[model samples]
Target: MPFQHPKETGYGHVIERYVTRKDSDHPRYLELGSRRVLRPGWPHAERFTRHLIDDAAAITDVELEALLAYEWRSRLTAAWLIGVDQRTSFRERIGDLLLASEVCYSGGGYCFALARLGTHADAEILTAYLDRYLPRTDLRYDQPEALGALLRLDAHLGTQHADRFTEPDGLWDQWVQALAHLQDSPDYTPAEQRRWTDLHCDFASGWARP
Candidate 1:
């Protein structure tokens, strides 16, 4: 099924108000959330992660949900906020967004959130996403991250839920075969062992440090 129009997916007034803010009212967290991944070695990456995490923590659940309804930038930051806080209450909704795959760039955040939640339910969601999207070789949306998250959950839960996907002639194998140029490229890494490291990891590290 195709996605609903962006105009129809979100609360227009709410998203407009949130996205059009000035200075302090603006959601700086959205802009800062990806800095860690984009500039991993910069001295300020950790600080940016900490600052965004703090900002995310300050957002209300209603506000966060509204952000999730908006475009990729807002959805990405909202997912990070929800994940960092381990708000399992939003897990189903986040899972829906992951399966929706409505837009690019935000799916990794959804995968991150589900992985942080780390429940059988979350694994199911990631599995469902892979089950649906992995076979579609034309679409490159978050397959790596979703698979990474599912494997992470399997590791944490002591289960083999990811085996079906990793096995020979599996969806993953088919997906790799579709990547014609990248098939034997030395630079290509399989999603099974790939780590979708992003802002959440940096925030966790910043908090864990004494």
Candidate 2:
């Protein structure tokens, strides 16, 4: 959607107004509740999220739900927005948002959002979900993308379930290929490789340390 400031003032009002804006030829505008405002493009997503952080108090449960329900592509945008909002206090609040549902638009966006938030106390909660929900044959194409997000988060947050990736299945190859493409350059961190090694010991172990 084309960028347009809300006619109304205040972060909440601005988000609310944006939500109500009629869909145009561009991507749809999403009103994620009183505190959250989402535009179609990644740039606009960043801008809108910055606006929300400026007025964090306005964030509400309704907006969180809207974010969770967001489609996968949009969820990635939402993830970026949330990552920018990283705050210790927001951990509990964001965890509450994820608690509402498990079946969401699973994509790179959703993965990042969950991973970013997973760095907080909420990480424990999501770790459980990740342990239980991950490694499925379904979403095989998307598994690498999801695993990349999880590995990054595990690296940052130190998840106990890091070893889950080390399974002998082709998951490691998938992870290597996925990480190579998902990131700008094919570089893996020690922590990142730890998760990879846990999944594919031979492949990760053989690689020289970066």
lDDT of 2 by residue, 69-142 (tens): 44333333344445434434445434443433333433333334455455545446455444443444243233
lDDT of 1 at 173: 76
Question: Which regions of candidate 2 fall more than 4 Å away from where they truly are?
Answer: 1-58, 65-81, 87-110, 118-122, 140-146, 157-160, 167-210
Model 2 residue 63 distance off true place after TM-score fit, in angstroms = 4.0
Question: TM-scores for all candidates?
Answer: 0.77, 0.43
Note the Cα lDDT for every prediction shown.
Answer: 0.69, 0.41
Per-residue C-alpha lDDT of model 1 across residues 89-208, encoded as one tens digit per residue: 899899889988887888878887888888999999988998898889976788877887888788779988888988987888788679786576543344533454433443454553
What is the alpha-carbon lDDT of model 2 when measured against the actual structure?
0.41
For candidate 1, report its TM-score: 0.77
lDDT of 2 at 194: 36
